[model samples]
Target: MVAGGFSELGEEGRMLEAQVKARINGTGTRVIGPNTVGVLFPHSALNTALTPNDRIYYPGKGSVAFISQSGALGLLVMDSITEFGMGVSGFVNIGNRADVTEVEVLSMFMDDPNTRSIVLYLESISDGATFFSKAMEASLTKPVVMLKTGRSEESSRAASFHTGAMATDDRVLDGVLRQAGVICAYDEVELLDYGKVLAYQSPPSGDRIAVITTAGGVGVVTTDLLTTAHDGVRLRMAAFSPEEKAELRKYALPIASVNNPIDLTADGSSEAYA
Candidate 1:
């Protein structure tokens, strides 16, 4: 169902895309895309992605469902997911969305029992009101993460050329997504990182964090990073209780520090980690 050379090609292509959309408007069958790579559902063994199976590794069964606007970018993310050992439940590349939109797909994922988290890579949104409502509703039960491009004028122009899309204002988009409780990712790395954490772990009860590292310098940097305010949330390093420090000292080497950073020195081992 996914074919390129549609609206992105200009006026003629736009007309062609409109005709295709009209033909499928009333049909019960939902179309994923007219110019897209297609969908992949690992649990069902369904793979309609245009990217060859051998080109990139598909992750194992996971609770994260990823939806992307760019097929190539989706493939790149899939490759990264494999490298990071992150699993995915489904992937959909809805390029030049002729019939199906992100809102519709998001609603389906929201009701999917297998999906615990949703990640999206979008150059543009088709219907702002529908997207906001759907995303807001879905975020109430599951984490909805998004990496929206086109923040810069140059990038916006490029997105327009690539997908025939008009980019929304970056500030407005940020405010709207934030109000909807959608976690916004700045890049691909953040997108997957957020997805993995949400899929595998429960939400933290508090913003307090404890860093355990073999490298002292890494611990310091991590403490600084955690303590910094992100959005409106700030994380502080948790202070260790005397009993906790005593327990740590039993496992740590004589020279190891039992403070909040809990630096176990370079000789730290699996037993120490445990």
Candidate 2:
């Protein structure tokens, strides 16, 4: 049940929102949002988004549960889910959060057997302590990745205007989230990418990774990216032994280099990949 013109507009809007919240104070029913597009459980075919069906198609069933504070951004992400090759178990648009907040939705997702990972696009946090505690608990079982915007002073002011949210210090927020075991994403793409990877793959037992590519430059870039520290996880490129290189050369082209990346050159074939 999402209705805009609440809280973000002015005093009248805030009063209206307060009244609405008061009405649901002691009810059996729980509301997700008063100013939101609403929730979507894709696996169950339950979609309450205000966005028209024609504007965004279902991204198919997945194990990632997404919660967003911005309705428009949620819709945009939903529209791109298919392109991103990630699916959704559930999606929540927690706009204004007059009644329900991100903490409640996060608890639901954490207990949901269908959800393997959680992603969030948050403009602000309503309750910092509760959010940190809930996120820490949830991340113990599944990955909780967040894309928190409004880092800049100008952007924070803009966010206040957009959703009536107060901005916290970015550095402190980042440290708090990290300490809570939440993976912070810099942008929407990183959020989706993290979700996609977590959805499709098991967590690596070790930080050592091997890269194999036909293009040398691509392998180099990937190696560079992996070796960098992310959320305190430092990845190291796995080194191939001489014997390992010799065995790989039997399958690779003569010109192929048998380094850590194992570049197979332009003439690399399917057998080389195998």
Best by lDDT: 1
The superposed Cα distance between candidate 2 and the true structure at residue 31, in angstroms, equals 2.4
Per-candidate local distance difference test: 0.88, 0.87
At residue 197, give the lDDT of candidate 2.
Answer: 89
Q: What lDDT would candidate 1 get against the real structure?
A: 0.88
Q: Write the per-residue lDDT of candidate 1 for residues 1-274, one digit (tens) a residue.
A: 6778877777898899888878877787677777788888988988887877667788878899999988889989988998998878899998888888889889989999999999999999999999999999999899999999999999999988887778799999989998998988888988999999999776576778888999899998888767766542357788889999998899999998999898999999998998
**How many Å off is the CA of 80 in candidate 2?**
0.6
TM-score of each predicted structure versus truth: 0.85, 0.88
